[model samples]
Target: MCFDAIDMRVFDELRKLEMFFKEETRRGCSIIDLYELVQHAGNILPRLYLLCTVGSVYIKSKEAPAKDVLKDLVEMCRGIQHPVRGLFLRSYLSQVSRDKLPDIGSEYEGDADTVMDAVEFVLQNFTEMNKLWVRMQHQGPAREKEKREKGRSELRDLVGKNLHVLSQIEGVDLDMYKDTVLPRVLEQVVNCKDELAQFYLMDCIIQVFPDEYHLQTLEVLLGACPQLQPSVDIKTVLSRLMERLSNYAASSAEVLPEFLQVEAFSKLNNVIGKVIEAQVDMPIFGAVTLYSSLLTFTLHVHPDRLDYADQVLGACVKKLSSKGKLEDSRATKQIVALLSAPLEKYNDVVTALKLSNYHHVMEYLDNETNKIMATVIIQSIMKNNTRISTADKVEALFELITGLIKDLDGNHEEVDEDDFKEEQNSVARLIQMLHNDDPVEMYKIICTVRRQFMTGGPKRLPFTIPPLVFSSLKLVRRLQGQDEGQDENPFGDESLTTPKKIFQLLNQTIEVLSTVPAPELALQLYLQCAEAANDSDLEPVAYEFFTQAYILYEEEVSDSKAQVTALHLIIGTLRRMHVFGVENRDTLTHKATGYSAKLLKKPDQCRAVYSCAHLFWVDDQDNMKDGERVLICLKRALRIANAAQQMSNATRGILFLREGEPQVTAAAIQSLIELINTEMQSDSSTPDPAADAFFASTLRYIQFQKQKGGAIGERVYVLMFLGKRNVENLSAYWFTTKSFTTNLMV
Candidate 1:
């Protein structure tokens, strides 16, 4: 069928003839005969040489001699069967490595580098071989079947035989399996159940891969678990996922989730109380995401929802106050922080309260039940007492004050919307049962308070604690010591509504008036002192009361503009009883001829000077000429206007309106009108381009004419645009003066 086969058959017949010859010689075949027999065996010799190399290593460890022998076999196979057998031998030798051949010495022909080069050569050759064989397999219809069968058989032999041999090279690795062989095998097994070779591949992966790559290699090899393996199940998947989770958790960043906090029970909120109350079961990733979501809600949710806020904060407080292992540690710190957060961000709380009209929450507070009540009272007092409006803010503070006291008196129920309202009913009835002067009842009422004083501060109890209640009791003790007077005990008299209790109550209030900044404290104290006065009591102390009232009046004048204006108006009205009327203003007028002149030198400063303007009196008259008034008084003012004093735009403008009206002083009015027209025409002087200001003022003046078209009224208004034009004018145009103007200008 082939030349080599024919040669082999002829050679076999010759071998029988040669055997007869060898039998006669009674010895093995000579070297020449053996050489000739192996000459055509070059194509097959590479396989023999490789086997010998491996055998050498197995027999002698790394010290075996294999290189020189393999090189000599390579040369001996060269040109043995034209290019066919020679090329095959050379290709095979390329894969035979000396380093893997027992590390024998220089005597070993090839080294590890030789093995590497051989791998490259053989891999490329295999590619070429595949191309050639595949071409034969599909060459044509006539030869395709025979060619493919032969090609496949040859390929199988080449792969199975040489793969393990190449694997023995000292540095040769299994890339052929990974990049080539295994991929093909994997594709084949996608639908195939014959998994023995696949198992072999996986087992080799375990042995051949490094520890770092072993698990990952198994993962890749498993692909998507085509079907669950008997050994590997969902639990196995879960186990790996858990290990991955642990690896992720080793990071110490704040990326932990809210669900992880040991005490966190729910969501965070803008409310100081609720923010301190959230809880979580166990730590996880994404705390930043949850925290930011909470922040977003806080920023956007309406702050004025007090009822909603109370519900949320109340729930939070209840949750945190639940008994727990963390009660002594995180709970205490969190509570302190919550209390401080309100004070730190009190502006937002104030704004929210104002928006919701929930100021009553701050007003009627009591420290007896709630720990935060004192701060609330302080802030409320500060906010309300500093205000200056007709609004009745003091009502809230009063309700808080006396309401707490009323609730403390036994039989009171609702506690007036202050702290712990439900329990007040029980306390109120118990309080009524006690003897009015019983000290034991007071002690019971005081039990809920933690401390009476601020830390590191004054020894006296805070005024917010309703110190009047304590001071009243204390004053009673002092009065009992004052003299052994025969008067029935003032504070403890058992008669219904005892006079002593009333006196002590007044005295208690007097002490508080001395301390807390109640908005009505001064007025209430004044009333008290007035009632308590006796005929012979030092009159000067009443003077002191007057002095205090005077001081309060001054403070209000400076602190509140509306009150100052009202006070000035009241003083003016009172002065109308004595001095200020039209009669007085007439007497101070200046005399002049041709035009009886009247002038207010600077009416803008006149408000300050008019503190005494009411000292002059005048009676109303229908007819008046005030020209002489300005002529005398403004003689000096005119000199000052020309020299020292620079009149304000308002003052100058008013002067032009009064004196410069042609009906008053025609020459002066004509001169100003000429000057105004001159300025309007000048372009180089950068005459104001606010030409509309002129037109607007003109239109208005025309509207205000006395005759409904009076030329004089138009002139009066037109004079106002002097020194200012259009939008640039910031001066007031109208004045509510007592006098109309000079001459017949009215």
Candidate 2:
């Protein structure tokens, strides 16, 4: 019968009997006659149980020497050879006699009794119970062996309880535990040759003892580990012990000296190695888990010793190297945890980078796992706000996370698009975190990032390269600030440290990104760099950037809307540029107007052409303005707007439509009025005939719209009214607002 199915009431009856013995003893019953019951009872199991209960009370009563009573009862209980009955009977004896042992201050400690006697009693009982428990495994038929093992496992606590009792004894100090208690218990655990018992009792030894005792007696406790049955989970046993010791070390700062005094880490390190060597059949997962636990212990106990942490990683690397790459999910998961533990502890990836074998251990993980680990490494950097400041450090960081940066070994598995993008985007964000206080060094960092991200293929270039471009531009601004009053280069490297040279580098990087066919982003970056150059008064550099943008707009920007937007940006950027001489300014402005005129949609072309009128007229600087060119741009815009209106009317087959007035017409009217105002304000006493003709044609168009007398005419009248208020010397013009209003009334 299983131990669980046995009549629990039997234990109740035993409790009743135990109470009876206690009452009888208190009432001064015959203690000698009570001891005689052992020899006279029918069943040996019942008789031994009764004798132990009575012996407990008899010892407590102080009628006889407690040592003699304990010794007689222990030897007498050995008669019942049945495993189940023997284990329960011994468990009963242990229970009833727990407080009655002849330890130091106990009632039975007088005369020849001592703590040793108590130790002897518990160890002897522990040995017998372990033997009986191990024997139960072999008693059943081979087919029922598993069943008997299960039964034996349930009964293990009954056996382990003795060690608990041993640990609870106030008299058993570190000396006694090291000398007698630990060794005797390990002897039975080893000699029993049962996997279940060895596993359980070794764990019991670790748990039941004080950490100080474990720390002091680590060698003795760890020495018995290798002697256990081969199938025993020695790794789990050792891991638990190390975990406990680590916690103990972490519990008090004062206790660490003792750990070092005992060479705790060294002893654990050696024993784990020894255990791995002895347990040759252990799986790689188990070995790695053992190293992981040891790492935790080291981090807790010897957190300052990085070499020790590295040494643990090195050991893991060696073990993994011998086993080749770990394909097992559990092993790889453990390896990731192993690598991440230090990151979490220090909350710094830079510190993790200092460990030599940190990345070496990662080499054994598969690609997907490597990506996961790489992501974790990046997260550590971001979470800790760690700055990877040097070029070499950036290079090292990229190397560590190469799996996320690019495809390795040409593995073509289809990655989820969003997931891949997110991973690469994290790499991009990490790029921004790469900073150095030195401008020259910061330049080198950007170069290093570019070199690394260039290999990320076209898919990653869009995400990764823009940060480099911006970083390079940022470096330029810094160098310019440093060069404020100095003629000589602040950095000795003139070729590399100069703002112009860095712009060249940015041009090259953005050029590469453009080849990724990401023209829009490329164009945006180019314009940004151009603006920065203009701010720095590097006119030639600014011209080159604008040139690159124009080339992209002509060659790559195919969408009509994109072209319109690009042209507006080009015109707006050129309008703000002050460093450009007339030649470069006009050359770029001509290209901008030409591109605007060539847009796919007429409305887009008309609006872009009108917007380009600003490029020809510079309000902030004098020499860059060309009134004639501005008049020409306004005329060209008016013509395009009229063409676009004609096309709209033709397409819709509607004449003089009041609703849905084209935006281009209003834009042209606005630009024309501004240009006429500017011409009137200029110091030219005699206006050019072309400007006069342009102004006359605009007035004629307004009169034609006013004749229609609808929304278009009202909008035209409003435009003329606002223009009359702003234009100076309005009497100089042939067309006046009053005359137009008079014509409207008539």
- True-structure RMSD, every candidate: 27.4, 9.4
Clashes of 2: 0
Candidate 2 per-residue lDDT over residues 155-205, each given as its tens digit: 888998899999988899888888888888888888888899999999998
lDDT values, one for every candidate: 0.34, 0.78
Error at 649, model 2, angstroms = 4.0
lDDT of candidate 2 vs native?
0.78
On residues 72-125, what C-alpha lDDT tens digit does candidate 1 reach at each position? 444444333433333333334443332334321333335432443444433433
By how many angstroms RMSD does model 1 differ from the true structure? 27.4
**Per-residue lDDT of 394 in model 2:** 81
